[model samples]
Target: MKVRAATEADLPAILAIYNHAVVHSTCTADYQPQTLAQRRQWFDVRVQAKLPVLVAVGEGGVVAGWASLNPFKERAGYRFTVENSVYIHPERRGQGIGKLLLEPLIAEARALGMHVIIAGIDSENAASIRLHERFGFRNVGHLPQVIYKFDRWLDVVYLQLSM
Candidate 1:
């Protein structure tokens, strides 16, 4: 698989990947599927901010996963700090697509002069937590039972990597 910057054409696949996680997994706490327009707007905002949105294209040019570096907070004080997000196609998890996506995402963050990259993982998502740890992200904080999803309280673990 090859990882590259996401294009407008990749939005549908990106949306599908995210909505799947929203409805079927604890990867995200969102309970409803997002609309295509919402995804479009999100892409626009990221582009306008000069942030990187990358996609992992596997065989047959299908998007296997995606990763991005987003502003950690709207405040200017957080400009140098970014949050990283990675989502893989449900059918293709455990095949290293995330590893492929993350390496470049971190490179992009550093290239952009970012000071730190943050990852907020669900406490139950050991796989994701391990992935961040492997990327040199250290556990910085954990919020216990801070989210409710799938009829259960969920904890959020925050990890940080200093660039």
Candidate 2:
């Protein structure tokens, strides 16, 4: 597999992976699948900000996963901090695609002079928690029932890695 910065052509696959999680799991708090136009706008915002949007390409050039660093908050004081997101195609989960995508993202963040990278994850996502831990992200906070999804209250765990 090869990891590279995503092009516009990769957005559809990335949106599909993200929407699958939105519909079938509590990985993201978003209750509805985002439209292609919305996803494109999001991509444009990231690109305009010069943040990294990376994709993992697998055999036959399939987009197996994608990762990005997003502004953690809108406030000016939060400029040096970014929130990390990674999504793998449902069929490609557990194959280290997330690791491949995130490892490069961390490096990219450091290169961009970011001070910190945060990951807000569902508390029930043990695999993701473990993956972040492996990358030196420490659990900084846990908020109980902060998100309502899948007809239930979902807990969120915040992890941070200082660059």
Candidate 3:
């Protein structure tokens, strides 16, 4: 697998992976599938903000997973922090693609002078929690029933790694 900054050509694959998680999993709280236009806007915002958006490509040049660092908040006080996101193709999980996508993203965050990288994960996602822990992210807090999706209440777990 190879990991690098995302290109425009990678957006469709990223969108597919992301929307799949949104529609079928608790990994993301967004219940509606995001459109290509929305994903394009997302990419534009990250570019405008000078944030990192990375992708992992497997054999045949398919995007196996992706990761990004987005502004934690618009307020000045939050400028030093970024929220991290990672998504892998459903069939590509358990092959360390998530980790491959994330490690470079974290490094990019540090290189960009970000002080903290935060991850908001579904409390039930043990794999994600463990992934964050392995990367030295500390569990900061938990918000109970912060989201209602797929006819169920979902808890959110916050993890942070100080860079």
Candidate maximizing lDDT: 2
Task: Indicate whether candidate 1 or candidate 3 has the larger TM-score.
Answer: 1
Residue lDDT tens for model 2, 47-155: 9999999999988999999999998999999999999999999998999988988899999999999999999999999999999999999999999999998779989
How many clashes in each candidate?
A: 0, 0, 0
lDDT of model 3 at position 100: 83
Question: For each candidate, C-alpha RMSD in Å?
Answer: 0.6, 0.6, 0.7
| lDDT agreement of model 3 with the native | 0.92
Off by over 4 Å in 3: none
Q: Which residue ranges in model 1 land beyond 4 Å of their true spot?
A: none
36-139, model 3: which lDDT tens digit per residue? 99999999999999998999998899999999999899999999999999988999998888788778888899889999999999999998998889899999
Measured against the true structure, the TM-scores of the candidates, in listed sequence, are: 0.98, 0.98, 0.98
